[model samples]
Target: MTKKIGEPEKDMSFLDHVEELRWHLVRSSAAIFIFGIIAFLMKDFIFNKIIFAPKDPDFITYRAFCKVSRFFGTDGLCIDKIPFTLQSLEMGEQFSVHIWISITVGFIIAFPFIIWEFWKFISPGLYEKERKGAVAFIIVSSFLFFVGVLFGYYVITPLSVNFLGNYSVSELVERNIKINSYISLLRSSVLASGLIFELPIVMYFLTKMGLITPDFLKQYRKHALVIVLILSAVITPPDIVSQVIVSIPILILYEVSIFISKVVLKNELKKELKNG
Candidate 1:
């Protein structure tokens, strides 16, 4: 029943809340756009070096896989080359993709700032103790996102490029990979994995809201494992090695989410006991 600081001793009208949200959005958007411009300026390095790195046989992921295969006395996991070339069909498609990719990269680079802006918008509604966790929220979320992006880039992307790039229905037909299509694959892999890696954060909130519990997660462990495998297959190659590599991290994240739910529940119970 304590009045929140900056509550003005009066309830804010709906329009006032909307106005506040609009400024947060504006700031977040500005951050993304500024970083986008920086990415646009480095178009050459972004495109040829970072974006297209997975298409090269000697990419770090491929080299690591080759070394691992050699250690195992098998070449099955080694990727020799990606057998497709990227081409833009439409006149302005390449330019359009360039602009969009820059924007996407900017969003990724400015993620921490965006999250901070969001936290600021929501923090006023939270208790002082809850607001104190904002820093941890941003740090953990950003760390998971970057890890997912790196995993998608280094592991999933290479497996996908190697498999689909070399796949042929018939020897007579050659695969012509469109520029936008290739970019789309890369974008989906990185962004989807990054978002998926926020499992623990999601679980924490769900636990706080009384919507989920550690027992619930534990009961559904088998189902979650099946779903994780399906997701891995969707993103990476159909091969066991690639699917297993992707699935391992996701499975670990699920376990982590369960642990987080337990911790949140324990804290909630402690707070209830103290209040009572």
Candidate 2:
């Protein structure tokens, strides 16, 4: 992609900037397609093991929960089957699901490269120091994203499937869930966490731009807690225990972000003093 040129005041024409962005979009699309093809070829691994895993009684998450419950002398997660069965109403439903799921999988695997392409596009406009410090952007961001995805897949998704799938009013009422519904839950949980784990990165940029400060974060600490609790409720099952458990790590991340903001502010001050 062509670099954005000219000074801050005399920017590249809007069309020129758009043209440059177009090329980046094109490259990113091609990358996603390439990865999608790879995912399509791995159908057995993707579907049997990964996608349908939560439906199995002996899935790793269920086993882990069972172990925890046995140790604590509480109710365990072991079950013979989910009360629900997945079905496709449309003729092309399975094929459509396969293609879309493959593309999303492609996006996840190609995420680092996509972020690198974004950084490349924006690097030309950044000061040298800013660019240097951001050399690890793709690696760090990708690591956080994968961590979030794992958390979602292993913890959140399983908990949800177990709780919701087994919940019933009576034996007369059987749950017949759709494939789309199940996949949607898994996808949303994974993608949301993947993006949420970039919290520190988002804070870092705002800190660098002087748009946010440690003091600001500290001032709104209680408010942040409420927001976090609300967010936890939104994403997780309606159980308070589950919400609290998930919120803990996220709150910890916010605290860490505050520390990072403080360090960044101090460094900025030192640089100013040195220049002066």
Candidate 3:
């Protein structure tokens, strides 16, 4: 028989545990599928308002950058236009892109449900006190993910699109970007940023399992900075301004992870003392 929620986990056999996990995966997949359908139905909004928005000179990010540039007594950051045209070179490319974009949107919209399913699978192994923090974990993680998505969309995506779209090797060269390539860049930026923002949660769990400690994180702080800069360079456009902007938030997240690890370790120590 399948183990019900709140049932004692001790009674579950190995097979039963596998069965439970399978059900959680099924539900998560179903949620993603349902959301994907919804996204597929909203084609105009997704394509025109979201996917193509960054290419416009009057986009919110571009406007904001222009204001900042003007405030600094220069129009260096002002974007006039993105000098590129998106083309679909294959017959079924547009259809394929539509399906993939819908799936990506579905996954993003269903992220909370996916996290809940994952928590359900693992919560059985945690202590009661730890389990009680489930709601907080879900809320904080989801919030951070959304914030990171917005940051990627508004900051990194614009910087990258503007620079790459306008770049030219020579006056004779024209930029005709493939739709697949453009979408791929945007998707990677958004998803990578969202996952990177979960640093604190990952640190807490690693600390709880005694796999890592705050000292370990602190000792490698400089190393982490180097890695963050490297990561920023890889993700954003090859410009000092773009790389620095991306690196700052990631470095902040790393520091926050260290603090989270410290707190988790202290709490673990207190619990051990009480038991001893």
Candidate 4:
């Protein structure tokens, strides 16, 4: 059984702890399955409205880019169309893709519940004060993840689709993009951005564990910039605008991580001094 908040802590054997974890996993999986079924039922909206939105020339991101270009007295940034066709060659490809896409959407939608399960499993090991911060942690983490997802969907996906879809090495080569390939690109972008945005949270926990310090982050800031640029290049299309846009937020997150580490260390120091 799940422990209620503010209840007295109970000690358990290793096997008992494993049993507790099993239940948490079961519940989290159940939540994902339920959401997946809902996504399966909403196939049309999930596919045409969301997964394929970046390919449209009139997607919000593209239109915003066009407006920015017009403000600068140029229409060069405007995309008229994505010069590629998405096709499925195999007979069972569409059905398989549909099932996988539903599961992916379900995972995204159920992320908060997954995090809650994670917190509950771990909170028993934390101090009373730390356990009380569960609500804050869940809210902040979920907010960052969703923001990252939107950034990927709106900013990164459109830029990449526009660049790669228009790229041509030879007139003889036709851009018949496989449906699986297109979906893979979109999935990677959205999921990668969501995880990348968790840098500060990761730093906080690392600091608590004495694994990292603010000074360490500061000293490696230049190296981190290089890595971020390389990562940006990998995730985004080979364009300066796309790389810069992606890099800016990641760098900001790195800086925010440093600050979070500093705060965590300071709090720890205060606790040590009080105890001493």
lDDT of 4 by residue, 1-276 (tens): 334454546667899889989999999999999999999999999999999989999899999999999999999998788999999999999988899899888888998999999999887667777888999999999999999998988988888889999999999999999999999899889989998998898999999999999999999999999999999999999989899999999999999999999999999998888868
lDDT string for model 2 (134-184, tens) is: 558888999989998888888778878877888888999868887888888
TM-scores vs. true structure, each candidate: 0.95, 0.92, 0.96, 0.95
- Candidate 1 stretches with Cα past 4 Å from truth are 1-8
RMSD of each: 1.5, 3.2, 2.9, 2.9
CA shift of 179, model 2, Å: 0.4
lDDT of every model, 2 decimals: 0.88, 0.85, 0.91, 0.92
Best by TM-score: 3
Off by over 4 Å in 3: 1-13
Give one digit per residue, the lDDT tens place, for model 3 in 172-266.
Answer: 98799999999999999998998899888888889988999999999999999999999999999999999999999999999999999988989
Error of 4 at 96 (Å): 1.1
Which pairs clash in the backbone of model 1?
none
Ranking by TM-score: 3, 1, 4, 2
1 or 3, which is superior by lDDT? 3
lDDT of 1: 0.88
Between prediction 2 and prediction 3, the one with superior TM-score is 3
Give the range where candidate 3 is weakest over 10 consecutive residues by summed lDDT.
Answer: 1-10
> Backbone clashes in each candidate structure, one number apiece?
0, 0, 0, 0
